[model samples]
Target: MKISTFISTLALTLLMLIPFNSNAQEFPDLDKSPMDAAAFPSKYDEPKKLIKIIYSRPQLKGRSIWDLAPVGKVWRTGANEAAELTIYTPMLFGDTKIEPGTYTFFMIPGKQEWTAIISKDLNVWGSYFYNEENDVAKVAVPVKNDKNNSIEAFSIVFQETSKGTDMYLGWGHIRLAIPFHKL
Candidate 1:
């Protein structure tokens, strides 16, 4: 009975979250990062779809996102709802092993490196409810700066490297790549 009750409550909570995420888009006109960016899935012409990251893209409308997303803080990894990463196969994310599943993605930004977290918690609006105990894997990745150019909107793009896929989280003028390979 408890299991059934838990499932029902979980379902309702997810339902309520969608509306709040929409409400997050209702920012003032002068506000930067106004677009509640949501990235859809795109498949590469490979064996099958490998990984999918779902998150919103907030643009840097001439204002520095650094004011909103400072160093040494936990970013929701995107706007609105929490960013989610879905792995289709067994793989290695840095030194951590990740099996096929979906998990909430979070990041703690620092001056030199960023800590990437794959958390068990779901349906979270942002880092507001982030719990370290629920983390499945956490690894530090060095920051990559594109000094010559700046990204207007936050984006997640996959680059097929020689070893595996390099997942890049680009925002403002910063980009961090997390490498993952099939086992």
Candidate 2:
């Protein structure tokens, strides 16, 4: 009986060791444009989150900013999908009050200024389907050049200021800050 039981155990172990032709999930390689998120009160221990944004970072692989995002055209604000912005509290976007909610972020790039639009649309792939009717808030922010701080990857960061918070977008040598004043 003991010899038979040992043989059975050995056989089970060998079977487990043998690789089978099962349908294993194959995860693809890393994304060329990786998804990222930024939030106000950036610390993890912060109890309240004022605002947050989910976007993709597209690198400038020997491509100019105009190549990826054309001038005087609506951009999804990122690479893969339209940037998603969640406002936790009512905030004033250049006198236009924006309520606490999630919205799609889009931008129409220009040489002097950029029109930042907050739309009611959500889960959109790109600005290809952008509709003007869905825009809830639109603000024209002047483009600032920071030749010293040339950023290769598209990035959005929130910085606390005396007025309120500034959501700054940097790429190449261009920088734009969208102010969110406290209500």
Candidate 3:
């Protein structure tokens, strides 16, 4: 009887541990889409200061709009949710100060310097349908090729600095960086 009880407790503990493992096997039917705010408990509630950007598959993996993207080509810079890029704190891009808000991110990829554009319009596909007049800010950043092709998932991360913050976008063999100061 003791052996059976021990086995039962062990099984229960293993079952409880599954959800916490990031690499745990997931069932095929389980949906991984972003959940609504109410789905999380009150303890998880906190005002999100950071803007969330989501880039999904197909849109991200296929031919990227760089070098091969054609200089004048309009590209849908990111995926669902309008390829949203957020500024958590006030920042200055180039000589322009950008207030904290969400903006639709777009880029004009070039062999030398890439033009990064943020627009007030946040709902749309690739820049195939872009409007230059909608742009709120535009900054030029240089792109450097990496010897080792490292990044598989296209992503951007912001790092804080004494002056302000550095916005880094990593993908393919390139890393594009933009420095901003507090507005």
User: What C-alpha lDDT, on a 0 to 100 scale, does residue 158 get in candidate 2?
Assistant: 95
Considering only N, C-alpha and C atoms within 3 Å, which residue pairs clash in candidate 1?
37-56, 37-57
The lDDT per prediction is 0.78, 0.92, 0.63
Please provide, for model 2 over 1-183, each residue's C-alpha lDDT reduced to its tens digit, 9 standing for 90 to 100: 699999999999999999996768788999999999998978363568888899999999889999899999999999999999999889998778999999999999999999999999999998999999999989999999997889989999999988779999999999999998887
Model 1 CA lDDT for position 103: 90
Per-model C-alpha RMSD: 14.4, 3.4, 11.0
Instruction: Provide the lowest-lDDT 10-residue window in model 2.
Output: 41-50
Candidate 1 — which residues are off by over 4 angstroms?
1-47
TM-scores of the candidates in the order shown: 0.74, 0.87, 0.64
lDDT of 1: 0.78
Worst 10 residues of 3 by lDDT: 34-43
Winner by lDDT between candidate 3 and candidate 1 = 1
Per-residue lDDT for 72 in model 2?
93
Q: How many backbone clashes can be found in candidate 3? A: 3
Order the candidates by lDDT, highest first — what do you get?
2, 1, 3
Model 1 lDDT tens row, 1-183: 699999999999998877555455654565343333222224543357678877777777776776656677778887878887888778788777888888999988887899988998888897899998999888899988898888888888887777768788887778898877767
Q: After superposition, how far is residue 54 of candidate 2 from its true place, in Å?
A: 0.3
